[model samples]
Target: MNELLLDLNEQQRAAVEYIDGPMVVFAGAGTGKTRVITYRIVYLLNLGVDPYNILAVTFTNKAAQEMKDRLVKLFPHKAENVWVTTFHSLCAKILYTEAKNFGLERNFVIYDENDSIKLIKECMKEVSVEPLNFSAYDIYELICRAKDNLIDPESYKINTMVSHQYYREIVAEIYSKYQKKLLENNALDFGDLIMKTVEFFKNEQFADIKNKYAQRFKYIHVDEYQDVNYSQVVLLKILSSVHHNVCVVGDDDQTIYSWRGSNMNYLLNFKKEFSTKDIEVKEFKITQNYRSKKTILDISNILISHNKHRVKKVLFSNIEGEFKNDVKIKQCEDEYDEAEFVAKEILKLQQIEKFYNSTVAVLYRTNAQSRVFEEVFSEYKIPYKIVGSVAFYDRKEIKDIIAYLRVVVNPQDTVSLKRIINVPPRGIGETTILYLETLAKENKTSLWEQIVKIDDTELSLKVKNSVWKFLSLYDLLKKYKDTMYPSEFIKFLIEKTNYIKMIEENNN
Candidate 1:
């Protein structure tokens, strides 16, 4: 027996060894899911499978890195060859390789949320649309939902027309113009990474590239399978159609991303997907609850059993100690009282109950609920850390600076161009931006291209000077990019754009 199989239980070992057509591991919370996944990869290596033949896909870059680290520890030399990455990253690799086939430049940029919203707002400005009935955020959500379902703009417009006619007209127009802008600027949003790849694979032009990928990766393993959307499922199915050695590990009870269009239906009916191709599926359930005691498992099992739609499985505790502590339930008069009670109980657990080694986690339904608990914890001087909510990159000034950097990196990025065009309240206002947008559309070129040849005779002196100043500043930065280091370029931008002075004036 291999050393990797030593620590796994019967079901886990079975999953690691099952190398058939298709398999599903109904991994419950606290089960060693990553262990089974990594062990399976090792099992394939032990069987003399080429390391490059295996591909592991997870939900986040961090998880992918962790999986790579584990694999490197087990197989130091061969681990580097295995392809491990998030779905978006996988699609990005595929797209980057075949970008020229789709008329997109190899240097195409990826627009983040702020860049995407800024582009959408600029598009709205061109059409004289007000925010009374249609907001940029609302339109953004609609576009995301459409892409998640692999719905093209034309089909989305048709569907919207059949359902909501008024929004149909507006959204369809906006979606068409938005997609045109993205293509014109040679950029893609986060959703486009998946959506575009799916479209490319379905086209006959992608035959050679798809065949190369499908043949290269003989084994495919997807973690967090329950949160896959329509576009992601299609990509996986296409890639694995060649060799049906696909293994998906997930639990239906953990499907909480439906708000983002992630459907658990795909996970629940996963086997049915390959039935037409006659791929046999072996299902394994890991029910051993390693993290909780019998009392907690019993309470959880009862609570989840009431749900009508789910895979039938029991989480049985495997702990050695007899944990017969009754689950505590407390009632509070208000939110403040609840916070105080939770804070006191946490202190008692740490000090009096000798649970010093046990780290406590306070769960909240929403981010706003953290404020009351923070106040209570501060009153008691309790040391606590909030996990995963605040993102430093989401700050306003930070995004503004990133927008400037994106424009410097890729001059064709009109999304970034529009974002910082008048960010510090330069003389270029909405009317001036609309004029530039109309001129670019009429001339069939990028905003930067049109700005270089601006007809300042038609503009008022203030607006004309502002537009020229904006263009000159960008050109100066381009020249500086050749000699100045990144830090020096940032300082130059602050001084040239007067960004700091504007902030100070506003503050005073």
Candidate 2:
């Protein structure tokens, strides 16, 4: 046996060595699914398989990075050749390379949630819909759900069934306009990354491009298969259709992203989806629980057994000893009671049981549930640190800086251009922006292009001068764009735009 397969148990060893055809591993929680994934890659490498032919995808960047780090330690020389990344990151790379086929530039900007909401609001305003009547975020989510299910704007308008015809027509119009604006600005939102890649592969016009990638990646592995949406399933199926060498590892009962369009059916019917007449899809179960105690595993098995649709598997603790003290259940009348009980329990655990605050953790289902616990913890004088209160990219300052960078890279990015045009209070107000938008609509051009031709528009001299100053800032940055490295250009942008100075003055 290879050294890499020495530590795995019998079931995990079988899963790692199964390289003949399609396989689905029903990996229960705490069963070392990631370990099996990484070791399987090692097994393939030891068999003289080219690392460049392997592709592995997971749900989160952190998970993908962890897999990559483990691979680097195991196969330091050839690990970099494997395509280990999140689905969105892989799709973004494809979109960036083949963006011209989809009528977008290679340097297209990717809009975040805030940018998408802003554009949705603009579309609503253009279609004569009041923000008060319909929330911009709600509309943005609708469009996202549509895209996740691989529904384009035209298909949404015709096939979608809504309660009110008026609202349906309104949303369809807004969706069409929003997509048009995204293209005009040379941008794609986060959803567009996956949706467009699926589109590119499915389009018959791009058969050669699709075949090239399908042949390049001979083996595919997907983690968290239960959390993949319809578009993702289509993408994976298209890529694996040629070779049929794919392995998906996930527990269907662990599916929790249904609110974001994740369909557990894909995982539940994996055998049916991948099995062919010549080669039957193999199924393996890794049911040993290494992270939890015996009592916890028993309780989880009992609770999850009641689920109507799931693969039949029981998880047993691999740890020795009875371990009967881990399982506990508490019921409360409401969130307040639950919060109070949790805080008091934590206080007891710290004061009497001598457990450190760092050793204890409180898990909640939703972020909104944290408020009550926070209040209760404060009353009890318990020091707590929220793990992911606000994502780094979602911060206002970070977004503003990214917008500046986006504008520098792609001048047609009107959403980013609009975000930073007067960010530091350059005297060009909303009224001036509205005027420019109107002129841009009339001339059928982007906001940046309209600003370039501002002299041709009927605007106040003061507004025109402020706009000219903004244009000059872009001109200065464009001059150094090819000359300086990306890091150097960012530093130059912050200095030339006085962004850091504005932040310091505001803080003071």
Candidate 3:
């Protein structure tokens, strides 16, 4: 194993074999940070440490999957013991299994902003507050920011940004009220999962959990440590306190999640929290050149060094490269001409004699800036794909389809019902839903199920007819669900129910 790491750079070798108290791999760009971590895990297992006693955490699901795959290939049978997961996913499992102790349900749902906002609008209406004056997005952002800083609603500060002193009081009250409603429905917003877990650990019940994980994981490895916020760092500390074998891998220059609540304070204060007095502190500088060219490396270095405090390191490139002088700055008159210029450049690249789909990349500061190239590519019938913040699975149409699938799998999902009730245009509007919800609560059944037993003394004839139409369509789909795949069934149902026509015919 030592011979295997003989070829690694000094920093990489130190990271791979440094089995000590606390370690930080302050690697630079193109450095083998990942390589070192991978080899470190293998080395730990080789040192007679139980694979089940290792916990590795990464930022993205893709990274998690990659690490899992790599580890499995390294030790095929022992991989199951190793837990590699994202924060949200791991917390969800913990919260779910321990829901009884934490005032949550085993069969609860998770709601994104859209569903949470819909519920908030309902609550505001019921409370007789002016919904138009206080937007749902604004409320969500407030809650999110509060959670990011580990500040609960009660601890949240107030200022003159609000109208009256009572405004903070009002909003604070509403925030708690919204949380109660979500709890009643057994739903968690995106930020709530981890925040609530943090709360769980701070209290007495999680003392048992803290000990269990801390003792279970003899060594804990954290990736992208600089991108971790306060709660996450605290969680890491709790899990590593037992054995104190903790290793973190990150580059301060790449810590770009500050706006989303990440802070460099944790990385800087890590040494303070975990003392190396009875332990070892290893700082490995995995500074190397492999990925980027000289020009790209120089620009990245200059642009990123604007940050106030970062672990100092250097990157170099063996190959020379060039970039557009002055960033090719220009001001086009209109969007069409801008698109044209981009199209011309792409065409010129394609016409080059040696070009055989050679890799070419064009990057912009934002999604809006990518539009010109996208439009030009479309106009010229160029084959291209946009990989940006918005993923295909995140599109509204796709999510709506998923909502339907959710409802089909679990008919009790009220949120999915609210989304697709009038979606196909049966004309059942907000008023009908409010009335149906009242009866569902009175009967204590799912809204959709209760609608089946409707004694229409309270419903008007028009609304009753619309409800019948919706029920008929749902029944039709359920009757034939097994015959069709999700996409095909959705397409068929939309066409047969005249939903496509209704939506497309809306000229307004």
Candidate 4:
């Protein structure tokens, strides 16, 4: 390494030069993990590897941008050619240019949790099945797990705590149908995208591309490697087969996103998988932290040490500790009040010189706890973005509008359909839609269209009128499809659907 680049610590220096091998750098939080990754790319470039021959994957867009910035500072023109991107963004790019060969459309929409839940609810309605003691979120999780295991939904079955043979059979059936509906819309949940893409690479058609990508890239360096899911790891394994130059930097102690599908198994299995005849395996540790003070490091060590499976890690720091004595233990008065208290402390710190524009985040064990912080912050006009998943249920006006837009986008979405079915105090109830769906399927038309043409003899005249009005509103939406984005289309829907009228009269 050059003198300027050789300035990195011993761990960092080892991280940079081990560019030719399958190396795993076990870096603790606040360590120079970022610096090591950046320097590795420069080292590869210095070794006569083309910039386009290196791939660096990060977990977030912000990190991807930072990697590019760091690379550009060192090698100047080399930044533009290096592939530094989040998994989703990289997959989206691949799908945009190459997915057509794999039978996927270029313009396929990403179904965030809200879209998936909306679709799931619609399928439940279609099956005349009410959700049994489970929320839409619960079903989404089950679906995600199924996808992660690469279980083809066609032959999928749900084995759950529900002991009844009949109920288990019923959920499995509903799941099969729900998956078909997603496929019809060219939609894959986040997990499905990764899993399916892995499957695609394994198939004959993508085998050449896999070889091509691997040969094109000299070294594959992954950031936040602890956050890799099964499918992602599979993709990395395949792509690295050709070049056998993969470097991953992560701390097993920070493996905290199990609920979001991050697999701890990958880190544990990294060495065994990466070691082959042509491949070299090396391991390095970065125990020292630059970001945290000595006290903060001590606090983290005490708490994380309890995770027995975590690799033995210690955070050594020269910076002064925050507390005179380390106070590692934190007690929260339930999740909500804990957040409220945290919000108060953060707002108090906002007045300090250093705290300016430094976001004070209150991490929660669950999304529900975010509500407390949100309410407290909003009251004080503290600006913040609700990160993680889609914040549909979080926004009042947007949820109201999404209800209307979902009705327009996919009439098949059952949860919102159920919510809106009688929402306008529409005289139509649950049984009516079930019967209507059956009739619509029989006639091969929309339930709204089927209800419109059905005779009034079996139905109440009031119910008949509401169903006809619903069909007329759908017809109007069809007419104005040329004029609106999904948002404005929903705006038109509330007025045109007379849904608010139903709400107003019911409120009276």
Candidate 5:
């Protein structure tokens, strides 16, 4: 216990040792927020608290893994007992475990952003709406707002101005149909994880589910509390209503996810809301800065002071290193000039002080700005990485495999069917797909359904044979879908279909 407190400042120590009803620690940047949270978990464990009863939530998988890693260093055997995970992942676990209550199957698939968009497009097609009149992205944002606010499809109300009533009606129709499609497919988009979990807890019929979760989690910790949306907030409330031993660490000034329904009011009004419940809510401000120099902290403090709504706290740093002028402001004529100036500075740093190219960074407001910098860096032969962009999972090969799996799981998913139908140079072509689509629409069935009944159609012998072959492959996939693991299914799909060989042949 002493070792845990050795490196913590006084305020951090108080935050870790506070064993009470409710607490909020306003952890500023570079103020040892992660350290305080880990130590607090250790402190709770040291008090003979059951590790399984403790839940620590973070906004990202990386943060959760870091906390789990730190705990493993202290108690390797008990690290797995505590639940440390991102909000969406935890909600997914809850939804999967409690699938019976929600009528979801045990092996429901989780769709990502692309899958959601495709589903929306299909919804629009079903409604006979054009993408020009209503974009998929705009409808997606509308649905996202509704989900974040825990609004049901029947209760989805459009608050648009009178001038846009027609558009609003279109969006509402698409949203309703989109939800029905998801249910038919036995799939849940990322937002549904939180939204459905909140629904389960709020429904009186599932009061037992709420009580079970609330009883299981005696102590709850939320990192990045400012970034939680309405559904996440409700879920947290249900889980902590029993014990009320909830500790949240966040800085109101750092709430930057407002675009995605991150309500800053949740953090700002936490104390006021809890105090009304006759609960003792203690507040701690860990303002000691141990990461940056005093100069940087001074500038940051001045910048953040402009925010009107926040808890005022003093930030101090005792770092030794100092620069003559740490903050630099430059005005460039245009983006190209800005890129050239950055490249020149990088060269100068390497020439004068031997700073490595990897050590320097050029921050930009938009991902498109990286193009100009990449051109300039290439002109000067400076290697750089465009960070924060799609690094994985968006690759063509990965998407192909994921589409295959989606089709395997949900045969009615016309979007995934279209994406992989002609992929890997299958004999199926656009003309054949168009014919199949016409038949399906006339029969009021899915494209896959029409393909299975290809013999009843007037399709040419070649098209009919190709459709039969495709159907045979999917038949084999369906046969093994339940028996084999996803990994084994992927391997079987790749090997049996010669997808890897096709890629190699194309490359050579």
Candidate 6:
């Protein structure tokens, strides 16, 4: 037996060694699923499979990176060849290489949620649909859901039904105009990355392109498979159509992303989708609860068994201990009472069990649920830090800095330019910016270009001076773009833009 197989349990070992056909691992919570996945890749490599021919996809960047890091430690020489990335990242790579087939440039901008909302709002305004009546956010979400289901604008208009015909008509128009704007700006929203890749594969003109990738990746591994949406399902199916050597690891009970279009039906129906005449899909279950005690596992199993759609599997504790008192259930009158209970429980555990405050943690379903917990904890003076609060990249300061860099690289990125143009109290009021946007639209030019030719536009002396100062700063950054390293350029931008001073004043 290999060193990799030594550490795995019976089911984990079986899963790692099974490379004959399509397989689905019904991995229970905390059953070393990630470990099984990493070892399975190693197992294939030991059989003389080329690392370049394998693809391992997961949902989050953090998980993908962790897998890559583990592989690097095990196979430092061959790890670089493996395709370990998120679904969106894999699609982005494919799209970047074959963008021309879809009439998109390789350097097309990828719009974030904020940019998408801004574009949707613009489209709504153009179609004379007021934002107050129909929120831009809601419309953007509808568009995203449509894209996730692989429905194009024309298909959406034809198939969609709403109570009010006028509202449906307005949304359809906005969807059409929004897609047109995305193309005109050479941009793709987050949903488009997966939707476009699926589109490219299904297009008959790109058969060779699809076949190239299908033939390239012989073994495909998808983690958290239950959270896959329709577009992603189509993508995996197309990629594995040739070889049929796909392995997915997930539990139907763990499907929590339905609002984001994730369908557990895909995982539940894996065998039906992948089985063929020559090869049969194999199902494996790893039900050992490595992270919990027997009492807790018993309670969890009993509670989750009520879910009608999940696969029936019993989780047994791998650990041997007398943990009869481990399971506890408490009922509270309201959120405030629940929060108080949690805070008091934490304090009691720290004092009675001699546990460190740093070792204790709390988990919540949504961001809004954290407010009560925070209030209770603060009142108790409990030393704590929130995990997964607002992400670093989502911070206003971070976004403002990134916008500056984006405008420097792509002057036509009006979304990013719009974000930073009036930032730092530039005195570039909304009315002035709106005027420039109107002029740019009429002239068929970008906002950056309009700003560059601002001297020719009709504007007040005060507004013109502020605008010129901003342009001068932008031009200086553009001049040093190639000369300075990224770090130095960022420092120079902070100093030149007086960004730190603005942040200080705002904080005050």
Task: Judging by lDDT, tell me the better candidate of 3 and 6.
Answer: 6
Q: What is the TM-score of each candidate against the true structure?
A: 0.87, 0.95, 0.80, 0.71, 0.92, 0.93
Segments in model 5 whose C-alpha atoms lie over 4 Å from true places: 158-163, 379-383, 434-447, 478-489
The deviation in Å at residue 43 for candidate 4 is: 2.5
What lDDT tens digits, residue by residue, belong to model 1 across residues 1-508? 5667887899899999999788888898988788888889988988889998999999989999999999989878887799999999999888888888867799788888777777788678777789787899888888888888888778887784237887787787888889988988889998999999988878897788788889988999999899899998999999898998999999888888898889998988887875554667788899998998878888889999998888999999866446456577888999999999998888778765547523788888998999999999999988888778547788777778878877877878887777798978888887877787788788887778877777633778777788888878888888887698889888888888889988899899
Stretches > 4 Å off in candidate 4: 1-7, 158-168, 326-440, 443-508
Tell how far residue 485 is off in model 2, in angstroms: 2.8
Candidate 2 per-residue lDDT, tens place, 302-346, comes to: 999999899898999857546457677899999999999998888
As a whole number from 0 to 100, the lDDT of residue 158 in candidate 2 is 73
Pick the TM-score winner.
2
Clashes of each: 0, 0, 0, 5, 0, 0
Candidate 5 structure lDDT: 0.84
Q: How close is candidate 6 to the true structure, as a TM-score?
A: 0.93
Model 5 Cα lDDT, one tens digit per residue, 1-508: 7887886889999999997788888988889888887889888898889998999999988899989999889767776689999989999999989998777787677878888898899889989998887889878888888788877665664553213777777777888898887876677888899988887788999899889989999999999888988888888888989889889988877878988889888887778755545787889899988898888888889988898888898688998556778878899999899999989988878787657777887887778778999999999999998767555788889988888888887777666788898888778899888898899878888788888898998878987888788888888988988898778888999987789999999999
Residue 222 CA error for candidate 4 (Å)? 1.4
Ranking by lDDT: 6, 2, 1, 5, 3, 4
lDDT of 1 at 315: 94
Worst 10 residues of 4 by lDDT: 153-162
Candidate 6 clashing pairs, residues 3+ apart or interchain? none
Error of 3 at 328 (Å): 7.9
Query: Relative to the unseen true structure, what is the Cα RMSD of model 5?
Result: 2.5
Scored against the true structure, residue 229 in model 3 reaches a CA lDDT of 83
